[model samples]
Target chain A: MKIRVLVSLKPGVLDPQGRAVHHALEGLGFKGVDDVRIGRTVELDVADETSDEALTEMCEKLLANTVIENYKIEKLG
Target chain B: MAFRSAVITFPGSNCDRDMAVALEQVSGTAPLRVWHGDAELPEGLDFIALPGGFSYGDYLRSGAMAANSPIMREVIRAADRGVPVLGVCNGFQVLTEARLLPGALMRNASQHFICRTVGLKVENAQSLFTQGYDAGQKIQIPVAHHDGNYFADEETLDRLEGDGRVAFRYTENCNGSRRDIAGVLNKSGNVLGMMPHPERAVDAAHGGTDGIALFEGAMKALASA
Candidate 1:
């Protein structure tokens, strides 16, 4: 089984890299861009018996820092 | 008994020698240099330090990889047993990732790597790390990092403040740290994680000796214990 994990800073947390990219877009004459937020994705291949609970535990333990980030796991066929 | 200290060096750690030097200068005994792969730390350690650097090449996230290394299991156990642990800069990131400290270090607000000496206010002088300085005293310490912006929820910040766990505050708000927090102590006050490099400030030849008090403070605390 294969899965993808998306990790992003929480809504209220400041994303400096996202903000900098937004500024660069504006400087390049791109308009109508309200905001930008950056996040990362990690893809993993696990045993077919990998349970959802175990995946969640992986995110909570190391994939995402619960203090400032949130993660979502998606199953990919 | 003499001060038994250890400095754990991750593969990319650059300040381990400096941390060991500072410890030896204050404790009059060289700290054992332990590698990150070592699963067991030497027995009978009174102090442990995690120095700053691009640990694990700052991949994935700052300090994220090193925090889960083999040696950290032992460090966590030592910290839980009330052994004094100091984490500076990248080391601070590792502590947070290891959950030994609260909050996470994000990119600088300006999105630039800041490297310079900054003023810090000793917020809580009750910890073994800060007891050498006067309460509310302002001192100069050097900070150099790209991800030192500390963040924690408002409630956590309030609780840390209410419990007097905040150890140091940046006088100039060098980073976009929540509440201007530069350093924080664990709930038990046995672990300290700070963004500024006190080791860099320990020698007058390094431009200032303001950082000496922290090492001296640890020595004094261990001596009296």
Candidate 2:
């Protein structure tokens, strides 16, 4: 099974990197961009029997820090 | 009896030696060096320290990888048993990642790696770690990190404050940490996670000795226990 995990800072958390990128876009004359929030994608290849619960556990245990970030697990195939 | 302390060193830890030296200088005994791969720590440890450094190259997140390493499990166990654990800089990140402490350390509001001496107000001097300093005393300590900005939900922050778990607060708000928190003690008051490098400031030759009191306080408290 192919799994993709998207991890992002929870809303209301200050994202300095995303803000810097947003500033850079404005500096380059890009307009109409309201905001930029950065996140990471973690692609994983697992055995066919990988369960949704296991994936969620992975995110909760290590893939994402629940205190500041939220994670979404998607099954690619 | 000599202070039985240990300093856990992860793959990229750079401040382990400094932490060890600081412990030895204050406790008159060298701290045992433990590797991240180790599953068990030495017995009867009086103190455990996680030093500052780019552990695991700061991959994924600062202190994230090292927090899940084998040794951290033992460190967490020790903390639960009331052993004093001090995590400095990167070590602080690991403590949060390990869930031994609350909150998360995010990128500095300035989005730059800050490296300098900053003023700190001892918020709770009753902690085993900060008892050497008077409550509300101002001291200078060195902070060096990229993701040192501390973040915790408002409710948690209030609880920490209400319980007097906040150990230190930045006098100048150097990292934009919520409530200016520079260090926090766990609910039991045995574990402390702080972004500032107290070990680095222990020697006057290093430009300050403000950090020595922290080590001395812990040793004193443990010895009398």
Candidate 3:
């Protein structure tokens, strides 16, 4: 089974990298860009029987820092 | 008995020797250098230090990979037993990742790696690490890091301030850490994670000896116990 995990800073958390890119985009004359937030995507291949609880555990334990980030797991064929 | 200390060295740890030297200078005995792969730490350790560096090359997240190393299991156990642990810079990130400390270190607000000596205010003079400094005393320490901006939810931040868990605050907000918190102590005050490098400031020849008090304070606490 193929799994995709998207990790992102929680709402209201300040993301300096995302803000810098936002500034650069504006400097290049791009308009109407209200905000930009950067995140990470992790892909994994696991046994088809991998349980949802196990995957959630992985996120809580290592894939994402629950203190400042949130993670979503997507099951793709 | 000479104070026993140990410094854990990860694959990319650059300040392990400096930390060992600082420990030796203060404790009067060389600290044991332990490898990250070692599952068990030597018994009878009075103090443990996780020095700063790009551990695991700062992959995934700063200190993320190193937090999960084999030796962390032992570190965590020792911390639970009330052993004092100090984590500086990248080591601070590892402690947060290991859930030994609260908050996460993000990129600097200016998006630039900052490296310079900055002023810090000692917030909690009762902690083993900060007891050497007078409460509210301002001291100069060097901070060098890209992702040293500390972040935690508002409630957690409030609790930290209310409970006197904050050990040090930057005199000037250099990294955008909430409440200018440059360092924090765990609930029991046994573990401390800080962005500034006290070990680097221990010697007057290194620019200042403001950091000597921290090591001396720890030794005094251990000796009296």
Candidate 4:
């Protein structure tokens, strides 16, 4: 099974990179852009018997830092 | 008695030698060098230091990979047993990633890597690490990092303050850290994680000796205990 994990900074956490990107967009004359928040995607190929709990554990243990980021696990089939 | 300390070095760690030298200079004994792949620590260690550097190439996140290294498991256990552990700069990030300390170090508010000497106010002088300085004393330490802006929830910040666990606060708010925190201690006060490089400021020829007191204080406290 293939899994995709989306890790993003939690709301209310200041993301400097995202803000820089937002500023660059404005500088390039792009209008109507309210904000930009950056995140990471991690893809994993695992055995077919991998359980949802295991995936969650991986995110909790290492894939994502739960202190300032949240993660979503999606099955890639 | 000689000070028995160890400095853990991850593959990308660059300040391990400096940390060891600082330990040796203050304690008159060289610290053992431990590697990231090591699963156990030497027995009867008086102190443990995690030095500044781009550990694991700052992969995934600063200090994230090293926090999960084999050696950190033992470091965590030693901390639980009340052994003093000091993490400086990248080491501070690792401490938070390891859950040995609270909060996360985010990118600087300026979005630039800051490398300079900054003023720090000794917030809690009672800690084993900061007992050398007087409360509210201003000291100079070097800070070099891209992600040193400290972040913790308001409630946690309040608790840390209420408990006197905040060890140091930046005088100038250079990184936009919440509450201007530059260093913090764990609940037990045995572990300290700080973004400033105290080891770097220990030598007179290095432009300052303000950091020597920190090591001296720890050694004094541990020796008398």
Candidate 5:
């Protein structure tokens, strides 16, 4: 089985990289860019018996820092 | 008993030697040098110092990758067993990412790297790390980092303050740390993570020796223990 891990900063945490991108968009003659945020995607391959709970645990323990980031696990066949 | 201090050096660690020098000057024994890939710290380590520098090239985030390194697993285990661990600068970021300490170091509100001597107020004088300073006393230490801004929710800040977990406060608010936190002690008081470089200020010839008292305090406290 293969899975994707999407990691994003928690809401209310400042995102400087995202803000810089937003500024660049505005500078390039773009308008009405309300906000922007960036995140990461990590793909992993595992055995068919890998449990959802175990995957979540893996994300919680090391894949994502719960202090300022949240992660979502998406599985694919 | 001789103090057995270990200084773990990750690639890009520029301050490891300074930390080792400070430990030897104060403890009279050279700190054991260990590499980042090492699977274990020397046994019976009385003190562990994680010095400043751009660990893992500050990729992804400062201290993020090193926090997941093999040596960090041993560092975390030592911390859990009540060993004293001190993380300064990039080391502070590692501690936060490793979850050995609370809160995360965000980019400075100004998004610029800051490097200079700054004023700090000792908050918790009773911790093993701060007993040399009086509560509310002000001292100067060198800080050189861009991502030292500390962030934690209000409730968490309140709990930290109420529990006396805050070890140092920026007298000038150099960064946007909530409550102006310059350094924090773990709940158990066995671990400390701070942005300022106390190790660099340990010798008088270095311009200021205010940092000497901090290392002395930890050494004294642990020596008597």
Candidate 6:
């Protein structure tokens, strides 16, 4: 099975990189860029028997810091 | 009685020697050098110093790999017994990553590496690590890193500040650390994780000896205890 994990800073956490990107986009004359938030995507290949619980455990344990970031799991056929 | 200290050198640790030297100079006894793979730390260790460096090449996150090293299990055990642990620069990252300390070290807000001496305000004078300095006293310590920005939720931050766990604050805001926190202590006040390199500021000729008091404080307190 193919899995995709999207990890992002929780809302209300200050993201300097995202802010800078927002600024750069506005500078490039791209209007309506209210704000930008950054995140990371990781793709993994795992045994098809891997259940949703295991993937959630992976996110909570190491994929994302629960203290500051949140992660979503996506399974691709 | 002379103090017994140990400096743990994880693979890729560059400041282990400097930390050992600083401890030796202040305590008048050389610190035992321990490697990460070692299963045991020397018995009767009065102090443990986790020095800075690119441990495990910052894989998975700064200090993530090193925090899980064989040595850290021992560190966690030692800390639970109240042995004083000081983690500077990269060592601070390890402590947080290991869950021995709260918060996480995020990339610099400016997305640039910071390197230089910055003024630090001593916030808690009662912790074993900060007893040498007066509360609210500002001192200089050199900081160098790209991932030194500290992040924690507001509730956790309030608890840390309310409980007087914050050890040091950056006066100049060199990094986009929330609330300009430069260092913090564990709830027990026995473990400290600070980004500034106090080991680098112990000599008068090294620009200033602003950081000397921290070492002396540990030695004196442990000697009397």
**Native contacts recovered by model 5:** 0.32
Q: Residue by residue across B1-225, what tens digits does model 5's lDDT show?
A: 899999999999999999999999999999999999999889999999999999989987789889989999999999999999999999999999998888999888777799999999999999999999999999999999999999988888899999999999999898778889999989899999999999989877877988998999999999899
Question: Pairs clashing in candidate 1?
Answer: none
Candidate 5, A1-77: lDDT as tens digits = 99999999999988877888899999999999999998889899999999999999988877887888989999977
Of 1 and 5, the candidate ahead on TM-score is 1
Q: Model 6 misses residue B107 by how many Å?
A: 1.7
Candidate 5 clashing pairs, residues 3+ apart or interchain? none
All candidates: DockQ = 0.89, 0.94, 0.90, 0.85, 0.47, 0.63
Q: Write the per-residue lDDT of candidate 2 for residues B129-216, one digit (tens) a residue.
A: 9999999999999999999999999999999999999999999999889999999999999999999999988888999999999999
lDDT (10s digit) by residue, model 6, range A1-77:
99999999999888888998999999899999888999989899999999899999888867787777889999987
Across B130-159, the per-residue lDDT of candidate 1 in tens digits comes to 999999999999999999999999999999
Using all chains and alpha carbons, the TM-scores for the candidates as numbered come to 0.99, 0.99, 0.99, 0.99, 0.92, 0.93
| Model 3: CA > 4 A from native | none
Q: lDDT per residue, candidate 4, B117-196, as tens digits? A: 99999999999999999999999999999999999999999999999999999999999899999999999999999999
Off by over 4 Å in 4: none
Q: Chain B, model 1, TM-score against the native?
A: 0.99
Kindly report the TM-score of the first chain in candidate 4. Answer: 0.98
C-alpha lDDT (0 to 100) for residue B108 of candidate 4: 99
After superposition, candidate 6 runs with Cα above 4 Å error: none
What is the C-alpha lDDT profile of model 6 across B1-225, one tens digit per residue?
879999999988999998988898888999999999999899999999999999989876788888889989999999999999999989999999888899999988889998898999999988887889999999998998989999998898999999999999999888889899999999888999999999999888778788888999988888888
